[model samples]
Target chain A: MDNSQLFFDFAPIWQARTLLLEGFGIAMFSAVAGIFFAILLGLIVALMRLSRYRALRAIAFTYTQLFRGVPLYVLVLWIYFGLVYAVGIDIPRIPSGIIALALLNSGYLSETFRSGILAVEKGQREAGEALGLRPWQVSRFIVLPQAGRIVVPPTGNQFVDAIKDSAILSIIGVPELMKVAQEQANMYYRPFEFYTVAGLLYLIAVIIVSKGISKLEQRLARFSRASKEASSGERRPSEVGG
Target chain B: MSETLLQLRNVGKRFGDHVVLKDINLDIAKGEVVCVIGPSGSGKSTLLRCINFIAPPEEGEVIFEGRTWKRFHSAFNFIANRKYEAKLPTLRAEIGMVFQHFNVFPHMTAIENVVLGLTKVRGNTRNVAREIAERSLRQVGLGDKLDQYPEKLSGGQKQRVAIARALALNPKVMLFDEVTSALDPELVTGILDEMRRLASDGMTMVVVTHEMNFAFQVATRIVFMDAGRIVTIGTPEEIRNTTEPRARAFLSSILG
Candidate 1:
């Protein structure tokens, strides 16, 4: 209670190390799963957006606009609390949190994929088809490989954003890193110390991810110099994840 | 002459409301080198595209190797489109096309680009595909550059790789759509010379070209088109002596 000197305590963080580590583990797991599912779903949505059928394109467009327009916080609440009451299906906190993260990020990822796919020249597709490669084979072999180079850097940024956004799941009592910090701060009356540790954990994750993305970009650049030219001066989407 | 290898009977094509090609009839014989020449937008490239249904004609039929490909209805032709889609791969394998831009896949090395069709479409083993791809690249004088990606290759080299890619399939006929238009004037001869060798080897070829001398020398028959219609079809000597105003005007303008 003495105001003679400003002091910080690391004792509480050490005392709550096991709980904090477990919470951080949960958060990392959620981020990985969310981004994984989002990528798969994003690719399908991207293909649907580019589909020849008007009905499929309409559905995909609506899905993208709706998810992207809604705030991630509101989406989490709607899926976790609102869906149970409105749809008569009770969902667990972990699944609800993961689903919300996936839905919100997928809107962004699908757009990334769509632009990536579009950036591939029309002639590439024609060349593949002229070689007698089937439509699917053309996409899998020719278009997507070229598109993958374009999308990798942006998708890596999305992964970093998803890790930070996972903190929002703590509000739904999902017991992630932020949730653990909150409990420890309240218990020991050391909010500053606990929150700082939590922030550092997230920063470390981001730095590691950024390194991996750069390595991947370098490997892909060997194939086409156009990708290097393409990666420059691209209009970045407005940040909506966290 | 030899047997008819391909026939385009009354073929028509339009984009939206503007007609690109109409009532086009032509016959190609096996091992014949037919060069199509005209000004830009003459539908010469469109005609080549139709040969493989890359831009399937809206009217009439394309008869290749005695098999007929025709559209039933313009609006509800998805059924026809689907049928062609299913049958096209096998036929496209036999009908090789080298584009003006040399659309060689950028992500693959020269050998890999040539090997793709053999391994994927033809379902050859990787080893066998590599052997064939090497042979094809060697034929195009690119054996030393087989491991190089498209970006590392020059325009003429890229075109050679594209030709090798098409050639690797051992096609019944080859289609060249302005393949030398993108190259430098100095680099044009390398490709034209390679094509001349192809023609001399008795490969059936449909060449869309602007090089008048190549057409006059290598082509067994020269087709002069204007406004989506064939204005003249004759031997090089006959085309040189044609009295058709449009054909005569086109030849003089370019030749002069």
Candidate 2:
């Protein structure tokens, strides 16, 4: 319980620094990959949901509903471990983990994307229509640019969630941050010390991401302010997700 | 120039069961500025909207360029409002609509906003589009402010940019929906002045406005509307000196 003993107990961490660093890299890699793919997938799904075609909307609704309803942890486990057992195919843990995270995040983000599209002022659409632009052209040029300004902040927060969610993949031997921390702690019988380091790493990662989001938001503010000048400043849809 | 360029016959619109416009009819001749004026709930704006197919009439035909746009029945109407998405781009190009709140594209500079539809929808090359955009901006007296964004521009400037954007399309009939209604008192005249110039330039226009003075001064024809129906249609002088109670009652309320 003494201070010297606590210091001695954590001495092994310096030796495991390389393992921890590599683990952090893997965690970040997974988060980035998941977010990148999810954003693309979510965008397509959202457009489908907003399509005039009833069948496309129904399909997008069903997909988002199915993936969002499933717990992320279960999804990670099923994709990584259940594939070999149930589907007779072995997916390497990293790719499998990213797939699960991307699918889950895309499901959630599709709704966020739709909300962003809807949040755009109706005048943008009318202006496009009045200007002789087709509906598709209207969405692409007029509505999407304005909606992009509103969607970036929430989409960024989703990236932070992806980073945290990446930890669950450690259970399936993904060699991410949590997995490395647990392995080091088990080897030295020092769970508290190693786990604390993992938690601090996550906090630092989240802080970095949040700061990046603020800067991106400021950059986009100039554009949003211009588009919204003529309309009444009401109903900000920026906070679509945590 | 006196030939009729656009005609609205028995135009009507409804949102579910609540009828907003009913059996409205109007003819807009080339080189004429037809101003529709009425109270807030009056269908002056709705008539302009129906003409542009912004609010497609449930029953009627809009005859423009000597070709009738069948607005209601899909079987006979060559272009029903919602059904003619294919033809809308062409139809809309011929008729420009300026909203009450100038819906300028915020991301683009004033010149770019004016150039966008010309380049994208009209398929004009960048050089040609820029030339048209510059000329249009100059026409609206925004030549010096072409690089400014909507937020940087005053209310009057934004409306002018909107007008320039619409003008770049070379629309046959420009539909203005209370273009100056959202401006400050001082800013209103700048937009009205722009309108006056456009009318003088021989542009056929259908304007829905609350500005009584501008309507009286500039409208070749004034259509007084109430509760979605045209109460009276005549020259500005006729409207000003009308004895019709419906017209007089509404004018007294607004002109007061």
Candidate 3:
């Protein structure tokens, strides 16, 4: 109960290290799973929003709005309790939590993707078409590749957010990093040290991811410059009118 | 008379409340070079875009290679026209276009830009596409730039790569929409010279240009347009001899 005891006791944390690692492992697993699904769903929704079909675009837009408008916490509860309990489905809590997080993350990520694709100049698409590529072929080869260059940084940022957001799954008793900290804090009566350590671990993970994304951005930049240099010889044909 | 390769009938375009072009009728023959000269916003570029189905005309039928007339209707809800969609791949293959901004794939090498159409659209093997790409680059006098990317190239070189990209497709008709308008003054002649060589080789070309000197030197027929309509269509000699007030004014302003 004394301030000195709370501040100086490394003993409680050392004793509970294994439990913390277990929670960290679970959080990391779910974050990675959530990101993979988020990327897949985001890509599909992004393409749907860009589709020529009115109904398809409308449906994609509705889905993005519905998810993005709701809070992540509410979404997790809905997927875990509302949908599962209402339907009497007996799916495990951890899997349900991951599905919920991924679904929610996808809505925001889809907007990122849609804007990225739109950011590519219309002329790039025309250039693709002038080369005789089919519409789908243009999207796949030229549009998507250029759009990826613009989307990666933001998508990476979202992944970092998802890693921290994984802690929300603890509310459903999924035993993620935050859940472990709570359990350790309660058992050893060391709320301040345990939670602080948990926070520091999350910070470290985000820093590593940030550095990796920056490296990736630099590599893409270099590739773009090199490609430009290699193709630098031809003169433009004269314009028809000026 | 030369065999007509492309024709437009009753072509019209409207963007919201603004009319861009109206009731345009024209014919282009095989291996002919037609130049369309007009002030900005006169629908010259839009007309070229309509031919390639880039900006589908609001009302018109386009006939290419003596084929059935194909109509373009604006789809209010779609990204592109769905009804008149068939044969787009084939039609586009036969028609190559270059834009004012060059619009080269910044991520691709010069040869990659040229070879992409050959390999992806024409189904040529990589080796064969590379050979053809190199040949096309050489034709544009950029044989040494096969490995360079667009950003590394000067404005003139980037536009040439764009030209070579179109040429590699071996399009039956080429459309140039102010291709050199984005270039520095000193670089304009280099691009113009390459285009002249292509014209001499009998490539069917339609150029929308501001450079009256180049048009006079290269175009077999020059069409002057204003207010979204053609004012006159004639050979350079005929245009040079015209006494029409508007034509005289336009010519004098440019010449001065």
Candidate 4:
């Protein structure tokens, strides 16, 4: 198509903005739902892997391996087609796709969380115990807070991945951003305009989310520094006298 | 004489085929300050860890507060082998430990670290915990550093804060594992001074230290370990004047 025609035809994106808005809304809803479940599942699996019980660790290991080994497309297809068709379950396509994404994302996120927990120095655990804290309390307060700092950057990356991966739900006819673009392209017979617009929208979303995460990281770092300064303030007078 | 607070009976630990500690039988009286001095790999730290049940002994028993020793089993092995097991958390409100590396929670402020045990483990109100934490920090001369994170503190400051964190729990016994070893030479005295104050306060303590001066000045008794066993246990004067060649050699070497 000619550049002028492409530009004019793409004007329909603004005119039919409600459709685009609806698509964006659906993608966001699915991404948020998927991430919430993914985090919850990831935390459980991570804890299971760290458990002192051999069977519990083995079970968690198997779950991560099985889900992470398969491609996202296969998982989505299996959930939408295989499970829904074979079991004759009446679950909607959107919910099914969300479950699949959450399940898949959790496997990878679990490993991230596990590594973060492990990265914390062993001495911290000992210190917690020395303070008479129970093992569970140690994990909840000392270990997890430190681990959260180490895990956030990677977890933020996974969240970005989750948002992008929501596009895969389009295959199940959930009418996400990519699917909307696809339908528009097919109807207008202008693949270049619609697909480019869709790609830009995705880029914008990712950029905004990533910037927000960076801001959060900076704020946390500053908070930590301020606390340190306040503590050091006590020693300054003593150091000068000495 | 103080009452016996902790007893180690035929305590032994092995990692696979390598024995780390063996045939350790000792009793520590309450309010006694004992210093353990030994070469690296002599298991001085391991023995300290065993007191708090940080490391379980493979054989024998540990008695605390005159109670009989209890056996704990591993859950992982039981799940794999289909045998029921018992896992116990042996940490009591009585025992507190500090490591050589000053393992303060990097994410928490100094006051928060000190208050964590009081509020979370002891079930104290937040205000009460904070009050106790501040008092402990003041005792350690860290009164102004209530909100500082570990990474921002110097080695000596961090170690002092760790001591306060332990003291905030109101532990009856405190264990120190070479706490000053990681400090800069100039900073070492600050931490040692704080420890000396703790010792003077009649806080029950077992300290593993390389600083001979600190041990000589502060320890009520000094126990020397070598090759995973206690070679000598005596007062500083006894250790200094002993005719035993090993004791003389160790003392001279450390002093030199």
Compared with the true structure, the alpha-carbon lDDT of candidate 3 equals: 0.85
Q: Is candidate 1 or candidate 3 better by lDDT?
A: 1
| TM-scores of the models, in the order given | 0.94, 0.92, 0.92, 0.91
Scoring each candidate complex against the real one, what DockQ results?
0.36, 0.42, 0.42, 0.32
True contacts kept of 3: 0.48
Better of 1 and 2 by TM-score: 1
Candidate 1's C-alpha runs over 4 A off are A1-6, A226-242, B74-77
Candidates 2 and 4, the one with greater TM-score:
2
Every candidate's CA RMSD: 5.3, 4.4, 3.8, 5.5
TM accuracy, model 3: 0.92
Model 2: CAPRI class: acceptable
Q: Which has the greatest TM-score? A: 1
Candidate 2 residue lDDT tens string, B1-256: 4799999888888778877788888888999999888767776776787787776788887899787876555556544435665786788888888877788888889999988999987899999999999999998888899898787888889889899999899889898988876778999988898889889989998888878899999999999888878889999999989999989988888777
What's the number of clashes in each of the models? 0, 0, 24, 1
For candidate 4, give the lDDT: 0.80
Top lDDT prediction, candidate number: 1
Ranking by lDDT: 1, 2, 3, 4
